[model samples]
Target: MSPLIALRAFDDSINSNSSVDGVSVVKIIEYVVIGIVVLSLLALGYMGWRHRYNLKLLGEAIAHRKEKHALAHGRRTKDVQ
Candidate 1:
């Protein structure tokens, strides 16, 4: 082949290879971003679940206190009889 033809072929090859590399790099970045988002969401969900559990425990404790007070009051009244 002529020198000019050989140079043209080399340039075309380089361009195609660069384009492929660029696409691969973009795909890698996309996957990384997706992974980060998923992890953040999971962390937020766990925190929310923990907060709700604490609230439930607090409510149960309050209910128990009320019941105990009522029982104590009833016992005092009976003893006065």
Candidate 2:
């Protein structure tokens, strides 16, 4: 027999023996689990972005405060001399 005919026969044998109901249920559950994992990762990425932005804002505020303090201290010393 040809290769195509041999493959068709093998497929027919497999289909005849396998049950469809249990396989469909298992496939549905597997897809749901995969979707949950993908959604969890997306949530984690959003939280990380928010945390980084907050840290950047805090650092800028601290730097500005330090500069203002230094300028005021310098003027006080100049007046005394």
Candidate 3:
């Protein structure tokens, strides 16, 4: 079936009083599922961004510590340079 027909059928089913308090249970469930999907995508994006930022900070810290340790040893290695 076409999307329009499916939507029309859903609307008809809702209007035909297959609901509680004028709200279709299936429609509410669909909305809840959509909400969960959107929230999950947002959370995944946030975690990915945070992970990238933490990795950048960690690399910087490691480079700085490596340089400091090399300097204290009075030898500038090729890696530190």
Indicate which candidate wins on lDDT: 3
Q: What tens digits encode model 1's per-residue C-alpha lDDT throughout 1-81?
A: 964455556655554454354564334445677799899999999999999999999999987787778788873312344
lDDT of 2 by residue, 1-81 (tens): 964455556555665535366554334445676688899999999999999999999998887787778777873312334
Q: What TM-score would candidate 2 get against the native?
A: 0.53
Cα RMSD (angstroms) for every candidate in the order listed: 13.8, 10.3, 4.3
The lDDT per prediction is 0.69, 0.67, 0.79
The true-versus-predicted C-alpha distance at residue 13 of model 3, in Å, is 8.2
Give the residue spans of candidate 3 off by over 4 A: 1-16, 76-81
- Angstrom error of the Cα, residue 25, model 2: value is 2.2
TM-score of each: 0.53, 0.53, 0.71
* lDDT (Cα, tens digit) per residue for candidate 3, span 19-52: 7788776677667877998999999999999999
Model 2, which residues run further than 4 Å from truth? 1-23, 75-81
- Which RMSD does model 2 reach against the true structure? 10.3
Global CA lDDT of candidate 1, please? 0.69
lDDT at 52, model 1: 100
Model 1 shows how many backbone clashes? 0
Clashes in model 1: which pairs? Answer: none
